[model samples]
Target: MTGISYRRPSSYSRLIGVGGARGDRIVPNGDLAEALERDDEWIRRRTGIITRRHASREVLVQHLAEQAARAALDASGVPAGEMDVIIVSTVTWMKMTPGLAPLLGARVGASPSAAAYDVNAGCAGFCYAIAQADAMIRSGLARHALVVGAEKLVDFTDPTERTISFILGDGAGAVVLGPSDTPGVGPTVWGSDGRKGDAIRTTHDWLEYKYADDFRDVPWPTAEQDGPTIFRWATSVAPHFAAQAIEAAGLTPADIDVFIPHQANLRIVETMAHTLGLREDAVIARDVIDTGNTSGASVPLAMERLLREGTVHGGQTALLFGFGAGLCYASQVVELPDAVGGDGEYHADAPTAMSESEEIGAGE
Candidate 1:
């Protein structure tokens, strides 16, 4: 917090690179049929999720974030020591302190003086972090910032829960934002309806469990949501944000090149697309079909997928939005960043700017 200057700079902030890392274990719809009492077709029809990935016990949330940060850093050609800020967005961090940002900054070899911290805006976290990074760069607080969104929702998932078992997944995604000569990130449009907070949240209260005479009587907390509530809210409100983002960027819906909303559900994606009246040529991300709802990680993960597949290219304008638990939401229009291989896949021999020894404890 030492960099206190808040005056607006003459230049703008642009995303230079982006990368994503998914869990190793793939869980298909068949894997959840018994637990949810639902078959593959049913799951696909309802949530449009055919499969998802669950992080193994040995893979910590920090590991996924580090991998993503490395990819983004490598793609950007930005040295770790040059990082002025590192912001990690997540709600699934296991530790109560030393938040994921610092741990990720260490793993990614970020500067010791870099401002590092975490944000927990639920599934909307990535959008929130992006907005913050944009402000920091434009306001002269930082020149280069690494923004990451990672989640290990599997740690809190209840296997037998019908609404959540088939929806949640694990993954991390990252982007490098730096000072640019022109505006690449537009003004953000965000708001939260805390009145609807209970529509999605943990099943048990941590504070209540801690003070209980018999903790065993309290069930371990797991995620739960009012499905109908979210579906209705998202479909109705997301299009408004999308339109606002496009306008804020001085563009029209037809001018938008890509649409990357949070990959929460395929149905939601399609519904929002219809509402936006997106151009036939505009690419809409459907990464959720494979990655599932990774909460805070979904937006960036989806963005990486679109870029990797060459569906969207660097310099193209993309409309990004995120909404989830706490009824929080954020939307922005940003120019796409360069991807590894001209796509988003990382090359094995690409210099990551970090020595091999420094990459230790990545998955440990």
Candidate 2:
């Protein structure tokens, strides 16, 4: 090993800004009901999702990521040239090599020598990226970093698979980190159970299809999930991790101003909230009702929404938890940024206003 070593100072990194972007197409439950023969009420009762955004054939994951990154760069007032590190959390990238970070860095005009890469930890990806970014900053390897969680889950979805079809959506969210005198992000609590990896998954290995006689004829592997298994894991086990994150942050649950768990389901969020025993005035993100489950993008998307919508203000402490696929889980507490976008509103045309029929019929 090279003998070069460095020690971190007492200072910590802070999330200085935030931003989020969703696809143009809005898909409501009515559209899914027509195809699956399930009523809108049934879906709402089951998953608390009334609508979600699905990108058109023209929209790629890169497009959504870049939009959010630009907004974040503007919000932070930190030029892309000043960033020394970039990390993207994703699992829905179509292109496996070259990674999403380099492309995002190029789009945002990051420094030529910046360390950029992508990480895959399913829906827990955002939290994992945050944890790694915090460590890098604390270790003095990076001074400022941009962490993004983005997904194009629709590409892996089959509308006929009613369970996952109505739940998955497309979107991206981002945050900028910078050095601070005090801790802006707390210690992270993370763990995984690989044995339960089959609970939620997609099979897209090239090796499995490399020898196929006709690759075009192959049916793309769609996403699948054991809903009950995941629900039990999230509701029963995630609360413990959430508490650990709070403790690691040198705070108590009662001190938290907001609780932003992964936008997976309303029931899970409620259960976690109750288990944590947070103050009654605490804000909890319920973006899943409209944004659906954006997987890796859920946490940051919810965070940006909370900030942009004025539900939670800057400097308040918030607890963020992300868990799913690979049975992976991660949680941390952070101080909210003062602003979400360079402008007051990040997405001026957010949620894409659409007529009832057009919005619901987007799936067609």
The candidate that wins on lDDT is 1
TM-score of each: 0.92, 0.91
Candidate 2 runs further than 4 Å off: 1-10, 203-205, 342-364
Candidate 2 lDDT tens digits, 132-165: 8888888788888999998988889888786577
Tens digits of per-residue lDDT, candidate 1, 1-364, equal 5876555663789999888888878899999899888789999999999889888776667777878888788889989889999999999888788787987887778878999999999999999999999999988889999999999899898989987767999988999999999999999999899999999989988987889999998898999999999999999976898789889888889988899999889999999988998899899999999889999999998988888887788999899999998899999999999764223322334443344544334446
Cα RMSD, model 2: 5.4
True lDDT of residue 204, candidate 1: 89
- For model 1, the stretches where C-alpha displacement exceeds 4 angstroms are 1-10, 341-364
lDDT, each prediction = 0.86, 0.86
Instruction: Please state every model's RMSD to the true fold in angstroms.
Output: 3.9, 5.4
Q: Supply candidate 1's per-residue lDDT for 46.
A: 92
Clash tally, candidates in order = 0, 0
Itemize residue pairs with steric clashes in candidate 1: none
